[model samples]
Target: MALGGNPIFNGKNFRGATQAPPVPQAYGQNQYGQNSYGQGGYGQTPVMDAPGWAAQQNMTQDQLQQMYNRPAAGPAETGRMTYDDVIVRTAACLGAVMAGAAVTLFVSMPLASMLMIVGALGGFVLALVNTFKKQPSPALILAYAGLEGLFLGGLTRILDGMFPGVGLQAVIGTLSVFAVTLLLFRSGKVRATPKAMRFFMIAMIGYAVFALVNMVMVWTGAVQSPFGLSTSIQIFGIPLGVFIGILAIGLAAFSLIMDFTSIEAGVRAGAPERFSWTAAFGLTVTLVWLYVEIIRLLSILRGEE
Candidate 1:
């Protein structure tokens, strides 16, 4: 998905799913007369439309009353997305990730490395497939999570082995950031405003460019440091990696905000229930990115120590 915003919410689907439905018109005095405001609509007379008193028509008095008093149908009944649906689907995806992560954690080092490569390659491919797909597929989304878990597990194992406790620290950091960001969003202390979004986009582009350059430098042996220019270069005596890592983490957190916004819009617009899978997938992707940045940052900082 487009990292700036959840890529899952893009194109026409994005436009439609996030749109607010038109407000329902209140039935007051109109060309249809005063009874239009009453039960059974404008078609019935005032006496007949009155609750409990409307006994004489095709419907029983109790039936009419029940119909009038029936609570409005929710997203479940209307075949739309809801907070509950998103939560359940997101949980399922994360569960798959954890299960897959456990598999790698218990494997031999060589086997884990192999699985990591496989997972990285497989996850990247599947991520593209799922993001561009018009309709959300439960199978693909879950597969992406599992594959990503494999990769994460392997990476974490390798890093934690070299530097004890870094992995745990990173996990704690990730959770802390997530919890804080979510709390801020819920409390309305943080929001994805247009100005913030514009900044995010510009910063993301610069970060992506830097990441690509570093990858190239590392691959080509231009820099021997683990993180290439990021570690080799320094600004004000602090490794450039530190600043970049913090910035990356910030961007990832803001990305989570965008995901939350999109999901909220989707629910408001009465998006299809199955799209909850889409929401889940988007959230999973963002969380993974956040975790990776956090762990890498921890490793870099610990290395300095």
Candidate 2:
């Protein structure tokens, strides 16, 4: 149901129409790897530049000429994705979420719930703010993470109380999905292609509409069950909420794939380091959606039992 909120890229980093540059070749190289042709005893290579310079110097006359005539290094090669950068930023995001969750769970459930409502509201506002801002702000992104933590913590508590152990199950499930998706992405088993993206958009729209209608029914008391029509309907002897929950979880997983694709593209294109926050935010959003879906599904199953 587009559960985590609109993607932050929409207005902040990428407008309706903006594309990053092609992937760079020198993205993962050492900072000083570039070849510098300075006169130093003609054949005497400095220790720092020895390897690269020797390789160039050893080239055939025709090859040397071609190499010297090549264009300057592109942005991709000059400044690209680094494993360290992604790791540090991701850790920071997770830390914020955990810290926020801790406060919600240990201190006071009501306060935590209030914080979650605030976080949800604040996150929505910041998502729009960061999306539209010309430049990304680390502070805002981190703040979004914190707010989301509150929401997730409060949500986990509420669901956990009704369906004991669901919180831990959801946590494990979310991590497993993330790990598997990442492995597949790195191995090239899955990708975000034009066709898939198109389908995702259409499906997301339908899901959003359905959720909105369900919420209205729930709030208006048109359906007495906790989950409205979802809890009331059954298919193949299982609650419809369970079925919808599965679909929602699948959507969240696919959303992770999309997030990974975007991050890969950005890194290849030499996107500014600040974009790491955007990537973090996207992952957080997807994980939250995954957890929520799992919790709700568990609750539905428990209710049925």
Candidate 3:
């Protein structure tokens, strides 16, 4: 699955899905006691009946025309993944996330904070499980989305309290980024080429290392700043977080491109319809990452102001 970058569609889970399954054939004996057309029994030639041919000729012109006008079978009919399937499943996942976030909104601050921790930890574990699972599970994927939503909702509540309306701004920013990236991908202006994939992987490794180090510093109380090294360090007169946030946002946006490519490949390869859940899960993960980066960037800017 040289689809580029997304581990979810890296080509393993879709084994034996390179082509659509063979359509079923009707079985019957011809007048000569040979297999009927498409029966192909015992290496014998299939026979078409004269009556069947005559019946086809006897059909009215309008009936024949109507039959000819019928649309061809699509991915759904073939039981393969389709863009529509991906869209529907992705919407369901996002909806579940919203529902989870709503729970945080109605709860008290303490409970919400506790849920944020649970969501963060639970989401991470589910993410890894779903990523490596050979089969996609709708329940697990939806659970992961909901947990992520709780974490986002709690974080947003805290940040919005500090900087009014930043949460809304971040939402808008995230959507804007998603729209622009999708447009670029649709327009064929951007693709996850092999060279680009290599670069992405390298950058991802560097970013992951930095994030882990930052988290460790924060946990150990080595950095009193809210964002650990991001706030404590400065480039020129500006906080380093501003730069880091921008970089993270860029990475997240590119990750969306990767997801789109993988989904397209999966559809083209005739992957099972159930695998659409995997596509949805991948998109949700990237979107969550993008949202967090945008919100964090907005918060850093607000704090600086």
Candidate 4:
């Protein structure tokens, strides 16, 4: 496991995954006394006219019955990760997010905002905890999702209150972008290449720096605009937030690709089944980021209008 490859697959927890044990090669050449053609190949071969292939191969009747009765091994049975595990876990995380969001969306603004702050702080802590932990904790991942949901709900509420209908627009925008990105990735139009990943890392750092500065500016009352410099500053008469938002959306999309790459690698490498939680967590984090960026962009646009 290594960072920058995909945050989800990084760290000690995933390092254990290696190539799967080789499947037993079928008893190749010829089984028992089976001949090259119709004729018997050799006298030393097991008798072909035996009661069963097992008997011919020297396996006892009990062994034959046990083998026949053995249940087929699945991902769960084999302790290997699978697409279904990822889907179910990711759905669970998103469901938790929605549950938390529902609570904040209907609450008073002050209370909602307070909860939002709590969630943001808690989510950040848990995110770091889950990310760096040698083991993936489902509880922590779900907690992160719930907290993010609260933060998103409060933020969306505030923005929607300021500019009516923007919330709906943002939701649509987020979903549209997500669907398009997924389609592109599945269709092989986009990928997490080394060159693209390098660009993603650089852009992520730059965007993070700007976000930190913007938050400080807003907090210190250095920028009166609701979106801080993103709104106060303009490029060609359009707020800087617009360009930044598009860039952020692209980054989020690329992040999804990275997540996909990690999941694919894990499956191919036969990573442990529990690692699906890691996949789910990564997807949840990326989706939340994407939604926040889309909502903020919509809010900025609406505010300008």
Most TM-score-accurate candidate: 3
Runs of candidate 1 with Cα error greater than 4 angstroms are: 1-4, 12-60
RMSD of each: 5.6, 8.1, 4.8, 6.3
Q: Write the per-residue lDDT of candidate 3 for residues 1-305, one digit (tens) a residue.
A: 34356876664556767565644422223333233424356776634554455555676888666655555556676678999999999999999889888899999999999999999999999999999888889999999999999999999999999999999999999999999999999999999888888888888898899999999999999999879989899999898888889989989998999899888878888888888999999999999999999999899888988
C-alpha lDDT of residue 259 in model 4: 86
Ranking by TM-score: 3, 1, 4, 2
Which tens-of-lDDT digit does each residue in 92-129 have in candidate 2? 88799888888787867678778888978887787667
Candidate 3, pairs of clashing residues: none
What range of 10 consecutive residues in model 3 has the weakest lDDT sum?
Answer: 25-34
What are the TM-scores, per candidate, against the unseen true structure? 0.85, 0.76, 0.87, 0.83
User: Which prediction has more favorable lDDT, 1 or 2?
Assistant: 1
What pairs collide in candidate 1? 1-7, 2-7
Worst 10 residues of 4 by lDDT: 25-34
Best lDDT among the predictions, by candidate number: 3
lDDT of 4 by residue, 1-305 (tens): 22477665666445666533333322321232122222244575644564344433675677545554554454555667898999999999999999988999778889999999998899889988988887789989999999988988888888888888887888888788878888987898888887887888999999999999999999999999878999999999999999999999999988888888788778777788778899999999989899989988888887777
Please identify model 3 stretches exceeding 4 Å from their true place: 1-4, 11-13, 18-70
For model 2 the local lDDT of residue 92 reads 88
Locate the minimum summed-lDDT window of 10 residues in model 1. 26-35
lDDT (tens digit, per residue) of candidate 1 on 168-208: 88888888988898999899889888788789988999999
Local accuracy by lDDT, each model = 0.81, 0.71, 0.85, 0.80
Error of 2 at 68 (Å): 15
